[model samples]
Target chain A: MKRGIAGSLESNDALITVKESDKLEITIKSVVYDFFHKQIEKTIRDTLSELGIDKISVVCEDKGALDFTVRARLITAVKRMEASK
Target chain B: MRRSLLFIPGNNPAMLRNSDVFESDAVIYDLEDAVSVTEKDAARELVSGFLNCAGALPMEVIVRINGLDTEYFSADLEAVVSDKIDSVMLPKASAAYLAELDFLLTEQEKKKGLKKRINVVPIVELASSVLQIDEIVKCPRVNGVLLGAEDLSGDIEVMRTKKGNEILYPRMKLAYACAAYKIDAIDTPFTDVNDGAGLEEDCRFVANLGFNAKAAIHPNQVPVINSIFVPAQKSIEWALRVQEAARQASLKGLGVFSLDGKMVDKPVILRAENIIKKARKYNLI
Candidate 1:
């Protein structure tokens, strides 16, 4: 696992800027490759669907998480996003 | 009306006594593949006693007897014929095997003084069984035909994949044959309990294919199976709307009516009515 900020997210009054802004930072504890990027995107999309949320920026902090762990973490991030909203 | 037919080992006293609580539409007390040779007699005794005591259980009870090749098959039939179980499952069956069992069961039903005919649910496990499904389904007293994935895979010499059923074509053929007979078609269980999403996907797939029920190997899978078979709320609501429109049209001397820009005929109306009937059973409406 590598310790570094791997992903970011930010939200505000405007949709595009909020999605584009990178205030929320994540330090992934491991080194993962582009092979996981598509799955991570799908996990984020599906988790958002289950949470009944849309139009939100998701930044994933990956510590070499497998599919199950990725889904769980994405769900946890969505819950945190909701609480912070 | 079983949406989930759970397989419980006949030798397990705890399973035999408490399986009904899982709310499965049917419970199959298994005496065949699940039981070893030494446990066959004990399993039969336990299952027979359980049937006599199963007065208040709401679900259908089925007994999976040993195959005819085994020595235990005769005794298994002898024990179950006198009992009031819903069906007797004939495992590893072909057309010839089903014919023999059909005759035996009919004679047993008469001799044992059971007013109702004992139903036979056959497991079409071998390639031979799949090839002869049409003739096999027409066998008298045959209730439902079920797929046995484990044995089928072994017979075909295919490696079991994560998708678990590479034998989908043969399985679907069996389902089609059952539908042609207007009898129930049951799918095999998903072996992995941790794969809840996979289970739901498979249930929806089987339901779409017109399988009447699925067999559950474990209790945890029961609730998911029940929910998948139960009509969705949106579907029920739509069916209700169609039913109401048709009823009003009938009062106005119209034999066919248009609902949501689609014409409703006898079959469409019947489908709506069935949805309401199933909803009423589930108390959804």
Candidate 2:
């Protein structure tokens, strides 16, 4: 069974959805997409690497959140997915 | 010199980012009461990362971690014991916990290669902590005591009041203990954010009761609290006069002298000097 989605969707925040997958896939939808798309993607990848998480599909919807906030939401989502295991 | 210590929820990144804008004397990144249990780890990581990367904020940065007995305490300490933090606010503090935390902090400082010692301010919330205020304040790494009125009221089975009559005794006891130890005594946050009038009144009351600072929960409360706690113009003038008189007396080889017909001794001179120092800090002189 797939783990449930988690994280916040508040303003200046991000909502992260994590699900079990055969291979790792990361997607991002951000309000400041044109300006910070690459940086956001790098932050998500870096956070996942630090946590040693793979084989999971991650979706992040950002609303102008900073790198720390993005990393925090991703970590929380991963923890939630792990807890449901 | 902590006129105001504002509590920012650790889980809220936006608040943490905008914390310095409030210009509070200290900003407490709270991992204790503000964060939910499930989000504790994420909050700790976010706070630590932000502190490490954030360069030279205008205010002091403090982290309120879980109590020593909690399962999350060790992890919280591990995440937060960095050079970026000015102090650790220990919730539900007691003498025993303070001693243990002192040891833990030393170990963390050494392992992290932190050049300066991180100070600890104990929050007196439980009835047991209030009773042991003297011992708690005397702990080596202790820098101050902060009153936690909401938790304390719950512990004592008393209703918290806007006038704060129920907590008077405990507040006085904690304040006196801090004064005896020459450490800071911080009053609890006024929970009614909408009632600016009531908050101002409470700040004045606590300031009169010898509290050196008050914790604020909102940005709007910061300026009001800071203004109330700063020495008044008349008081600053009086302090300057007393300071000059004491200087003259000392030069004349006199330890005691009369100022406005009141005997000025060591304690009086010390109080005057403190007032003047505070005035200088606030740019009043």
Candidate 3:
């Protein structure tokens, strides 16, 4: 299983972890989960779809990360995962 | 020149969002020591993304790229060499290092088709760099020097004092070089963020030595540095008085003029004129 990580658990940042999987799967745990869970998931999905990445499981440990932050972390994680392979 | 340049970690999304809120004269998104090696790529991506979307920042924007010696230097340049940034702060700055950076910056400018070249503010921290400060400052695209006493102290095996006594010689040497070269001399940050009085004392000490500005690590230090570096209203009034007195003396064919029972001459008038000029530039008048 190839796994890659990016970002931090600091305030307004996300600790993004991506692992090899059978299909695209995302799990989000956010400090602002009550309000932004959907938005965060949508961001991850949009980013993965845009990058045309598949067969990866993305776990976004988000700490109130904005749209850009979420996208950046996901992209960085994807790149790191690719580099490891 | 900016009175204060606030250093913000490139990887922090929160800080990046509120960077301009502090009202510092400039903001330096740092891609160097503040970032961990593992996260260098993340920071680079975040910084470039932020600058791309953060359109038209009110104050001057700068990026402190990794030094030329590092493997990330090229990528750092590729990420940050944009029109949004007015300058880039190069760490571990030396004559040789600056020569390499100058060539690279020229190439970057050409690649981007930038009509205006990016300016460089080199960090004068290493022992070897202090000796070659003149050569570094005289290098192409060099605009200013920020004396990083923390690294300089460590480099020279000296105790870094809050009073900044140990780095006095480096301070003076850097100030002299910058003054001669007509560039800004920015003092390093006072690391103790809670000690406002100590921060003021350090600012005054360096300002008296002809340093025009200082770098701040925290938002609180911004106001403190600006208060001392910016001309006070009283000084502006006094400068106007001296200016009027000089005009009167010139009209009367008297080389010397009196301002509040004190004899004022060429140098005195020039100093007052500078104060007024700076005030005007800062819109303080």
Best by TM-score: 2
> Mind giving the per-residue lDDT tens digits that candidate 3 earns over B160-272?
88988899998999999999998999999899999999999999999999999999999999999988997889989999999998998899999987888899999999999
User: Candidate 2's error at B211, in angstroms?
Assistant: 0.7
Tell me the deviation in Å of residue B30 in model 2: 0.8
- Sorting all predicted structures by TM-score, with the top scorer first, yields 2, 3, 1
- TM for candidate 2 is 0.94
- Candidate 3: the clashing residue pairs are none
Give the TM-score of each candidate. 0.73, 0.94, 0.93
lDDT value, residue B246 of candidate 3: 92
> DockQ numbers for every candidate?
0.01, 0.57, 0.69
Better of 1 and 2 by TM-score: 2
Find the candidate with the highest lDDT and give its number.
Answer: 3
Best by DockQ: 3
- Backbone clash pairs for candidate 1 read A1-A29, A1-A30, A2-A29, A2-A30
Instruction: Name the regions of candidate 3 deviating beyond 4 angstroms.
Output: A33-38, A49-55, B250-256, B261-263
Candidate 1 chain A lDDT trough over 10 residues, lowest sum: A9-18
Q: Write the per-residue lDDT of candidate 1 for residues B1-285, one digit (tens) a residue.
A: 568899998766556657879989989999998888865655676567567655757888889999987889998999887647878999898888888998898889888888777788999888788888888889987878888888888898897664656768877897899888888888888888888899999889888877868899999999999899878899899999988898899899998988889999899988888888888887788
C-alpha DockQ for predicted model 1: 0.01
Docking class of predicted structure 1: incorrect
